[model samples]
Target: MADAPPSSEKSFLRRLTVITQPVLTRIAHGSAPFITTFALIHLTAPVMANLGGTSLASQVMLLGREYYQTPFGEKYLVLAPLVIHPLSALLKRVLAPKPARRLSSILSVTGYTTAVIVALHFYTHRVAPTDPSPPIYAVGPSELDYEYVKFGLQTWPWRSWLGYLGFTAAVAWHASEGMAIIWNTWLRSYLGGPPGTKRSRTIGAFLGGVLPVATGMFFMWREPLMVFASHADRFRAAFSMSPFYWY
Candidate 1:
């Protein structure tokens, strides 16, 4: 039960970190665009709702879901990036020569937090209804429209409102910053940006785009439930599946 020599342990770690850095960085960066694309598609749902109400929103959501929720898209585009990006980033940070400061950076903080929020959202929307042990038909694809969001807000006004607002803001900001980083790092020459410069304009554009969606979603959440009322028991069961259920 003697410990391995410190020098040997340190040497092994150094080799592993050095060898993995580039690979991890590539994986993290490569998966970013897919996540960002989905984020944009997600933002669109609320905007459509704002402009044309739940009817329009449901149409848009279902259309987008047809692609991302499909087996191929879910595996390669949605689930893969969702798992790979954060995991790669986390491994990259842990393996970096100086990990302490890098892990505390805005990109790192927001990236991880956004990942958690997105996972919870996916579970509530996709996993809960289809759960084999107990089905929540109120939240199922066949019965639930996009306005199930309204049901959530109505059920837990403060928690739902705050959580949605924070999640949207973080996602919007993180995605904008991530895209800017990508542009500056790889596309500066082709895209006409100075290398090493931050893109406030990109951030501004993303925030502006999300603003309407946030407003629309907030109002939509506030709107009275038109369809969810009939399935009160199932709706409650669905809400119970939310990670924020206790809150």
Candidate 2:
């Protein structure tokens, strides 16, 4: 009689097929469209900034910047609507059951919609204010000016704060979930032994939760920290710059 496959071996095979199946499908269909979308966004940002407020190009670029910079912005703004919507739908049909597939589709759509709203909020507060004001440091690499950052914070006060909070929470949840999925698909294979399983899950959870919180804290505290640093009178006078300068 043929020997029975060990329970662990069976699990490994199931996971391996689960992971490789989607990868193969993507490869066969090609990933060029997704690549193109990212390239377009990158190429467009500077051109739009250069064009400033007068032209459509500039407006488009501003929109891109707003979408790209927000929390969970990358996934929802760029990937979900642009790439993952279709990918998730396909995956749902192929891998998930009816309810799971539906949930995945709903989440992807909801995530994308939230990103759009957040992007609009950013545009109204941050990007719109800069219009008609000569593009600050237009010739240099894109950098956030301390004044602009402060102005943004002060512009809508409560609304801005709420938006930031929502953005941060969405990002944290989405990113952590994505990481967990990837972990289960890839890392679990090599680290499947009982001794390492718990450790792996713990590490993954920590990374998923901690990274988003840290990012939110950074956004909240960054301006104050910069302002405090600017209080050195001697340094400010010598440099003819405020302590708040990003440097």
Candidate 3:
């Protein structure tokens, strides 16, 4: 009798609820850590290298050495674990339940601890010093060596490598599991028209998670492999003159 309160009003309210639901869902899921991790990777990598021992140009050139020299950069090695480890821990918690919960929690603490230790190590040895001078080597002739291949090896010896190994492994696990969860949650609807129309979605998701992590593992393992192959000396020779060498 009152014109049914106008069908347009009812339709508008329905549309508003639908639009707001997803916004609230995203907020509830918490994207802060993800955004933070992305930001740290992009911003900190170059800055850390630049600030490692000298000016910005020196750091950028050092970063470029990875391409022609040994496929490793100071910023990459340092920031990767810092970013990936925590993200991995987060993903592990999100995707895996029972056993993963405990494991992820442990990794979260360990990752943060590693980062703190690394920061402290850098600050004490390199940053906090008043006189930051490059190292001089007395080999063959008194020449300035600007190769930094050995820089990676020197930073983490066998024991340090073991720590990095643990960190990398954790990252791999976390990334894989996280990918699985993302697929299940986001692409599940489009996976197939009907629910579980494609039963292989789980397997597909699992592989998606595993492959990228494996690539990361390959990078992580390269340093140790070079060390074990009696190539540490060569690396040292190559990296001894790195501009980033504060010690």
- The order by descending TM-score is 1, 2, 3
* lDDT sort, best first: 1, 2, 3
Cα-based lDDT for every prediction: 0.75, 0.43, 0.39
lDDT of 1 by residue, 1-247 (tens): 9987799888998899878987887788899989888877877887888788777778888888887888799899989999999998888876787873466666777788998998888877677766555446434575666667777777888877777777877787677667767777678878785533346644574567657777787668767677735566666677787778855
lDDT of 3 by residue, 65-139 (tens): 443234353345444544554454444445332232354353345445545555543433233232223232222
User: Cα deviation of 191 in candidate 3 (Å)?
Assistant: 3.1
RMSD, every candidate, angstroms: 3.1, 15.6, 14.2
lDDT for 41 (candidate 2): 64
Q: In candidate 2, which residue pairs get closer than 3 Å at backbone N, Cα or C atoms, i.e. clash?
A: 230-243
Better of 2 and 3 by TM-score: 2
Ranking 2 against 3 by lDDT, winner: 2
lDDT of 3: 0.39
For candidate 2, what is the lDDT?
A: 0.43
